[model samples]
Structure formats: C-alpha cells, structure tokens
Target: MSDHVMACIDGSGHAMAVCDYAAWISQRLDAPLTFLHVLDNHPPPDEGNLSGNIGLGSREHLLEELAMLDERRAKLAQEQGRVMLEAARERAIGDGIAEPHVRQRNGELVETLSELESETRLLVLGKRGESAHLASEHLGSNLERVARALHRPILMVPETFSAPERVAIAFDGSKTMRKAIETLAASPLFERIACHVVMVGADVADLRSQSDWAVDTLNNAGFEAHGAVRNGDVETTLHDYCREHAIDLLVMGAYGHSRIRRLLVGSTTTAMLRSADIPLLLLR
Candidate 1:
C-alpha cells in the first residue's frame, strides 16, 4: 500500500470534516496526504429537459446549443472542482499536514477510486456529499459504491470534527469482525485510542467466547482493550453502548457474514450509519 492518505472532498458540509480527519490520520501515521475531488462525467439524471416537437432545422440548432452549453458547463465544473480541491488542501495543511497533494479527476467516484485505490494507505470521506445529502432514504450513492468496491479501510467522518478518545467495535464472531480486529490491531490509527469491544447476542450463545477472544487478541496486539456483552439487537445495542460510553469513534465490518458486494450494507450497518452521530470506520 502507498504511504499517502487519500481524502475525498466535494465542498459539501462534510468536506471540511474529511480534511480534518485525514490530517489527523496523516499525523498519526506519519504519512503524506492527498486530496481528491471527482467531477462526474454525466449530467444529473434530472437535468434532461426537452423542448416540444420542433422542425428538423430547429432541432439541429437546439442540439448544437445544448452541446455548447454542456461544454461550458463541463469547463466550469472542472474549474470548480480544482478550486474545491485547493481549498481542501489548504484545510489539511491548516490542520498540521505540511504539504498535501491536490487532484481533480473527471469520472465517477468509484471509477476514480478504482484507479487510485491501491495507491493509498487509508481512505477518508464524508458520510454524505453535495447531491445526496438531502435524500434521507438512501445513503450517499458514491459512498456506498466505494465501500463495496474496495477492500481498504474507509474512515467515514460526520459533518463536524471531534478528536476521538475511544473507539468501539461491534463484533459478531463472523469473518467480517475478525478482519476488522486483525486489520485494526496492526494499524497505528488507534494507537493511543482506547478500544471497546462489544458483542450483542443471547447471553447463553457463543458470543461471549468470541467477545473474549476478540478482547484478548486486541489486548495482545497492544490495544487498551476491554470486552462486554449486551443483550439486544446489534444496531440498537451498539448505538446505546457508544452513547453511554461516550465512544468517539465506531468501527465495524460492513455487510457482516456476506462477502457479496450486492449485500453492500446490511440492515444493522445501514441503521448504524444513518443514526449514529459518531465517526464510523467501516472495514471491508
């Protein structure tokens, strides 16, 4: 993996938070920082408006005008993307990153990330972006797609920045949770942060054993780790645990027990992302 931390910014309310989070990670891991702003190639699906039936000559003229308009819009979009990227870099520098790299690409978010995914150590992004923020029914489309496409760890920040003191992980004794445990243990991101491992399931189930194993593994890996068992649904229990314990950051595996990309985010994960106010470090 590359030593650079990649932070995606779209000048939305969450962009600043992304920069701050990326700076924190860069400082903690002693890595360089790169800011990326992607300008999608196609127009918004809602923007295609057609005029009433017109003569062939009129239609040709209208099409030409539309092409020109599209060209101008593309130019403006590229310029705006550059400005946004520059501002993001400045913010990252202001947060103590000495010199952050800025890049503007023209493509879908996942496409850009696919090209550069292997070139970054960590990916930092906002929970929502410009167009998708108002839609409460669905999470950020690009965010969901990127999470499904990459195996790298993604740090999803909220609109506001708060330095995390403690991190809680939701463990379900599946391979997904194990991947999170193993990856987090070897990373420096949570070095000084307290680790809280909790499992939510029947009291008599094997959850306790898995929770115990997770705690021991984390402890052995040098984390200030402790495990607890909560009796309730996974999402509700995690939300309450984080709130009551004042966990600053929440970590968990995405789409637990399913490696299929189509399963993207299970109900529990979706609910947690939508309701939890803390930063979520989602592992693939």
Candidate 2:
C-alpha cells in the first residue's frame, strides 16, 4: 500500500465535508492526500428497451440519436468529475495540505478502490453519496462494498464537519478490539485528545473491568483516557452515549470476535455506519 490517504467524493452535499475530514486526517498523519472522483461507468440500457412504442423507422433513427446522446453524456460526466476533483484539490490545499493530488477515474467506486488499495492505507469518503441523499434509510452505495472488499482503515465523514476534541473507542473484550486499542494508543491520531473507552453490556462488573483494562492500556501509552460501562446492546448503547457526551469521533474495530463479526459478515457495522452522525474511524 502507498500509505497515502484516499478521499472519495461525488458531487453531493457531503463532498465538501468529506474534503474537510480528509484534510484533517492528512494533516494529522502528515501523509499525502489524494482526491478521487469516480466517473460512474455503468452504461444505460439499450434503446430498444427504452423506446417502448416507437415505430420501426423512427426507432432506428432514435437509436442512432440515442447512441450519440450516450457519448455526449459520457463526455459531460467526465468534465463534471474533473471540475469536482479540481475544487476538492483547491479546498484541501487551502486547508493546509500542501500538494493534494487530484485524479478523475472511470469505474465503480469500490472496484477502483480495491484496485488502488496497494497504495492506500487509509480511505475517506462521505457516509452518504449522491444517489442515496433523498432516502434517510439508505446508505451510500459504495460504503459497505468498499468496506467489505478492502482491509484498510476507512474514515466515513458525515454531511457536516467538526474538529474532533473527544474520541471514543467502542471497546469489547475481543481480539479485534484489543488490536484497535493498541493501534489507536500508539498512533498520533488521538494524541492530546480525550480518549473515552465505552463498553455496552449488562455485566456491570465485567464491563467495568474490561473498560478499565482498555483505558489503562491507553493511559500507559501516554493518552489521557477515561472508561465507562453502558447498559444496552452495542449499537443503541454506543450511539446514545456518543450523542449524549458530545463525542466528536468514534473509533472501533471493523469486526469484533467471530461471534460479532461486524464487517466480515455481521450487520452491526453497517447499521452503525448508516446512523453514525459523527465521523467513524474503523479498523479491521
């Protein structure tokens, strides 16, 4: 992997917010930032199917015109993608990224990201893209697929941007959660930020012990950490805690232990991704 941060943005209301979050991560990691806008290459259906009841002669003429229209639309899409990329690049530069790289590629977003994974260690994008903006229940089409296809860390930025001051780790006593804790503790990403370790479950005593252990693990690594044990299931508990406490960032393992294999096969990660209003830093 190239170790650069890849920020994917379509021309949705979330595009600028994605840029802001990407710029924040790039500056914090001191890594190069690359802005990508994928020109959707999925072709439209044939004119025959589209032109329902037109006569044969008119249909042939319409088919030729439709072909020309397809070409024209493709050209326009490419041009529009370039403009979006240029605007993102300029915004990143203004946000202190010295040389934000910009590229307009043609492909499905997930397929492109999988192909580019070798050079990318971190991927950033808006939680909801252009297509799903109208439906509150629908997730960004590319989010889940990209998360499933690649093992790299993904930062899903919401529609608005905010500088994170308090970061929380949704800790569970699992190997994956342990790895996420160690990684977050060692990285500069959470340095100087208040780290809150929250665990969701009814086993009060066990949960406290686990939270303490995780918090101590982080504190020993030089982070100012606090621990809390919440009562409820993972999704509702963690979400409510973050909201009530004004948490700016939520970090967690993409998948937990086999029983709770969120990203690998479970729906918890997807559920959280759909509802999480703040930025999420997901590790696999």
Candidate 3:
C-alpha cells in the first residue's frame, strides 16, 4: 500500500548499481524509493600481535579497540547508505519522481527485507558484493537463501548495469510463476515496461493453458505482454532469449529443491545467476 521500492544497500559498489536500478524503477512507477542497509556479521579487525595480550589492561585495551571498530563500522555503513540513497534520490528527481524516504536496519538482509514487504512494492538487491562479479562461478550463498525465504519480487541488479528497456519473465507453469505474474500484474512497475512472458520446457503440449492464462492476466492488468513457448533445456532457452533479444533484465521464479534434486536436475536460476550477462528479477 505504500507504493515504495525498497533497495538493499551495503558498503559495496554493487549496492550503488542496485540504487541505480531501483531509481529507474521508482521513476517509471512513480513510487518512492527506500534504501536499506542491513548490518550483518561484521568482520574482525587484524590482530597482528595475537601473542602479546594477557593482562587486565590488555583486555581493557582490546575491548576499547573493538568498541572503536564497531563505531567506525556503523559510521561507515551510515555514510555509504546515505550516499547511495542520495544518488538514487537525485536520479529520481531528474527523472521526475518524488523524493524517496531512506531507512536503515541492523539485522540480516533477508529478515529485514521480508519484514519491510508490508510497506514495500518491490525489493531491489545487488547480485553479489564488491569483490565478485555476477557471472563469477562462486555466488554468495545467502543470495539464494534470501530468494527462497521471501515471497516478494526481488530485482537483482548486476554490477555496471543500466535500466531495462525490455523485460522477460521466465514462466514454467509453476505456482510460484503464477504468483509472480499475478504480483507483477497488480503492481505499477510493469505499466510502462514492455514485458515478454517466456515459457520454456522440453514439452510444449501443456504450455498452452499456462501461456494463455498468463497473457490474459497481463492483458487484464493493462500490460501488453506476449507469450512464447520454447523447446529445449530451461537454462539454454532462457539464455538464448536474453541474447537474442538483448534483454536488459530477466524475471524468474526462484526454484528451491533438495540438494540431491538440484544436483541431479540442475537449477535454471543458479545456472543463469552464475553466467547471466544481464540483471535478473527473482521471485520466490
């Protein structure tokens, strides 16, 4: 009901990219943007002299050092969050969007994002931290976990990315896909964006109903969406679509299966996350 876009921010440069994407969305949708910085586990400072501390004064000094470190970390977080939020606010203003309200939280990113859904229209997040690339073989383990834990639509901003011109929604006829489609339809984000609903699987016999339903749903919601059914592996088909169309961003339902199941069948989302050239909007 708040009609605000919530963007997750940290001290990473990719978080700035998230703000850029969120600002684009907020402007297009005419929604306020909220920047959130979650204070997860902090890293410990270097203890170069680990063998020289064994006295009461040493203990006190250590405590003081830790307290100072904590204060510095908190200040750094606040400053980075403010700068990112200001960048987004300025971009939004230039694009004719109203000023956004920025807020911060001290908790796990997943928990804070889920808790803010009541007042958030969409959640935007970066693909990974500053040290890694979105196409890197190693992804942040928490990223997938957060995608699985939340039911809201999450826009994963890739580093050095731009706003989307055309969007593709990965549809596999799953309940989560239906929910994602429904959520996007009822929301204002897709009002001006050109959306293409893609259904990919080995078989196409049963895709008609789902594709028709999706098209009808989008049409009813005032979106001009077209349906396409592809025959091949899910990952291959999706990657091909993105490449062929030069898609700026992709929307897919995050698939969560057992470890064994995932290993055996493979995960489309994981594969794409590992090698995707564009940003992804994931919904669970």
Candidate 4:
C-alpha cells in the first residue's frame, strides 16, 4: 500500500467517477491503487425524548428501534463499500492494474483518511459526495475536515474530466510548496502536460535564483515548464491565472505556517475549496 495511490470511496456516483480518475492517474504514474471506505458514526438517541417513556415495554421498544437503525446504517455502509470497490476493480482491470486492494474502516471519515495519509502517495477524494447537489464544487461535509487534518497531497476530482493537458501550480516558496514542486518534478504525470508555476508573494526578488533553478530542473527533465511572480490574494490570483491560461488543473500546497493560526484565522486552501471551480490538487 505504501507505493499505491490511496482513494476514498462511498458508493456515490461522484466517488465512482473519482475512482476512474484515480485509476487513470495510477496507470499514468505506474503505481498500484488502493480504495478505502469509511462508515460514519451517527449521533446517539435524544435523552430529552426519553422522559416521555412510561413503561419498560416502551423502553425496550425504543432500544429495539435504535438497534435496528444502527444495523440498517451498517448494512448500507457495507453495500456502498462493495459497490465502489467493484467499480474500481473493474476499472483497474480494464486499465491493466493488477489485483487492486480494498479496505473498510468503521470510524469517523476524517480520522480514517488521516491514518491513511502516511502510506499514501496521493489521497484522491471526490469534490462533492452523494449528499451534495449536482455540479457543485463545494467539498463534501467531511472532505473539508479531512483536507485540514490529513498531512498529504489530495487530488480532488470533479464529476466529469478528461486527461489534463495543462496544469497551473500555485507556488509560494514555502516548505510544502517546495515539496509539491519536487514531487511534480520527479513524477511522470507532468511529462505530457504544460506546467505553469506561479509564485504568489513579494519575496520573488530574493527567490529569483531559486526560481531560475526550478525552471532549469523541469526543463532538464523534458518538461515544458515556466515560472512567474504574481502579487495579489492567493485564491483570486490563481483563479484568474487558470482562467486566462485555460489551465485544466490547479495544484498548490494545502496551507502554510502559522498553521496553528488556521484554527483562529482561516486558511487559503479552505477558501479555495469552497470557491474554486476547477479541479484542485492539494499538497500538505
């Protein structure tokens, strides 16, 4: 699983589409793929409503109802898991991926995703889950929380997509940004795409040397890459740049230091997830 692409599935049509993207990317990167399904625990029964119960018969009846609800939810989660895994398995077989693996976890969605991050090369999640409205870019109820908690790269897939011809990378010269840049440089997924690396900050004058070095690095690897310095709000700048260049994908580090400050102050990554219409590849 360490060398494989890790993806989350919930039996939703959007999740199945994400599986296709994951399979495509895995084949492109020559990596195996693993699918994970998580069962979300529901809230407990309302204690306030218990006061109306008169007899042990009523108490027993309520307990049985609650137990039935739990059993039904569990069955639904498992069914969803099987559907997603089967779809992924079929896609993998078609794409020549051998014996893909699937796992199930009974817990909170965010925690399960976080636990998988360490061994995951890329955590692929749907832009929106089953409960969401169609054509919405809003992250699923759990995706936003998972993105903030998981310290790994996440590729958020839209409902419909073709192979990306061009990509726009939002670089700010931070450590995680550098990590994402290095990962892309080494990965062959960028080989067939035109890459535009945009660094948003006023410190570009000082980073001029490093920027030049990065361009050379990509060029030497046969990548058609370019670097630019832009000054403005990060989300707005990247959005406009992608629109202007007709970029099919947007890649950027998930967040920056003052990381703890994100608890108090909001994060740019979260802002983009809510508002950015394009597919986003987020790195921690």
Choose the strongest candidate by TM-score. Answer: 2
**Model 1 lDDT tens row, 4-40:** 7899988688888998999999998889999998888
Error of model 2, residue 204, in angstroms:
4.4
TM-score of each: 0.89, 0.91, 0.79, 0.84
> TM-score: which is higher, 3 or 4?
4
Q: What's the lDDT for all of these models?
A: 0.82, 0.83, 0.73, 0.75
- Per-prediction backbone clash count: 0, 2, 0, 0
Instruction: Give the poorly placed runs of model 1, Cα more than 4 Å off.
Output: 48-61, 135-138, 256-265
lDDT of model 3, residue 41: 50
CA shift at 9, candidate 3, in angstroms?
1.8
139-256: candidate 2 lDDT, tens digit per residue: 8767878777788999988889999999988887877788888888888887899999988877678778888889999999999999888777788888888988899999877754
Which residue pairs in candidate 3 have backbone atoms (N, alpha carbon, C) closer than 3 angstroms, thus clashing? none
Model 3: per-residue lDDT, tens digit, 39-157?
Answer: 65543334222324445556766767767766776777667767766766676566565676677677766777778778877788777864344456667665776777766667777
Clash pairs for candidate 4? none
Best by lDDT: 2
CA displacement after TM-score superposition, residue 150 of candidate 1 (Å): 1.5
RMSD of 2: 2.7
Candidate ordering by lDDT (highest first): 2, 1, 4, 3
Number of clashes found in candidate 1: 0
- After superposition, the stretches of candidate 4 with alpha carbons farther than 4 Å from their true spots are 43-59, 132-137, 201-204, 207-210, 259-266
